[model samples]
Target: MDELIARVSAAIGVDAGVARTAIGHVLAFLRKELPDGPVAEFMNQMAGAHQAADEASAGGESAGGLLGGLLSGGLMGLATKLNALGLDMGQIQKLGHEVFGYAEGVLGKEKVREIANSVPGLSQFL
Candidate 1:
């Protein structure tokens, strides 16, 4: 996860903390939108992954409301979340690539690819 943060930070020209927050927001969004099973399992196994997700969503909005917004707006909601974390769409795409590549290293390329493909709006970034 640290390596991923570093790589994404370098790729997007953001500080490590900003990179981490952005990555957390992206991962949290994915976790919510993806189905149960291996993807969820893998996310859980990764240290700090779930916490990152939780922290990203920790805000004034209720979790259900936030999730509802995400579901209603889809990529737009994702964009909003990423934007709140100080990342633009291009940076979000780059973050997706870096994070997916990091997932590939940790969870195997095929598994990560499968997970990426399963998410509705995620493939564009991949």
Candidate 2:
């Protein structure tokens, strides 16, 4: 997890904290949008993933007033959340690529491809 965060931070030119929060947001989004079985497996494979997702979920709930309610689901919502973390669209795409690339390294290409394919409008990020 630290390795992944470092990669994202260096590659996307964000600090480690922002990269981590952005990862949390993306993980939280995936947990909500993706199928349970694959997501569960993915989470299991990644160290600190559940922690990140849990933190994101908790933060989202506490912070979820009007804007959170407005951008509550799907790809656009995920984009809005990442944007809130100070990432532009290009950074977000790079983040996604780094994350997916990391996932592929750990979980293999086929599994990662399956996970990516399962979500609508997610391929653009890849």
Candidate 3:
């Protein structure tokens, strides 16, 4: 997790704290939105990723899945969620690029691509 934070911080020009928060939010979003599959397996391989996602879940950082109908509530809810974290749409897209690139490095392109395609409105960011 520390290493992921460091890489994201450097890649996105954000501080470790912001990177951590953003990463937590992104991962938590993915965990909630993605079906059980390679993405989940890939997330499982990352140390502390689930913990971060769980923390977001427990803290209601993701609106406690209030957008449940959006599957849950699509990317608008996610954009709103990320916006609350001080990231504009461009920054969020950059974060997506960085995080997805990083995930590809770890989990390979095919699996990461699968993850992106599986989530509604996620491929646009990717």
Worst 10 residues of 2 by lDDT: 60-69
**lDDT per residue (tens digit) for residues 1-126 in model 3:** 787888778876779877787788788788777748876886888898888777655554445355433443567766766666667877888888888887888888898889988886777766
Candidate lDDT values, in order: 0.74, 0.83, 0.75
For residues 42-117, write the lDDT of model 2, one tens digit per residue: 7888899989988977776545556766987888777777776778999999999998888888878887788889
Clash list (residue pairs), candidate 2:
none
lDDT ranking, best first? 2, 3, 1
**Candidate closest to the true structure, highest TM-score:** 2
Q: For all the candidates, what are their Cα RMSDs to the real structure?
A: 3.2, 1.5, 3.1
Instruction: Give the range of the ten consecutive residues with the poorest summed lDDT in model 1.
Output: 59-68
Tell me the lDDT of candidate 2.
0.83
lDDT preference between candidates 1 and 2, better one: 2
What are the clashing pairs of model 3?
A: 70-73
Q: Over 4 Å off in model 3, which ranges?
A: 61-72
The TM-scores of all predictions, comma-separated, are: 0.82, 0.91, 0.82
Per-residue lDDT for 118 in model 3?
Answer: 88
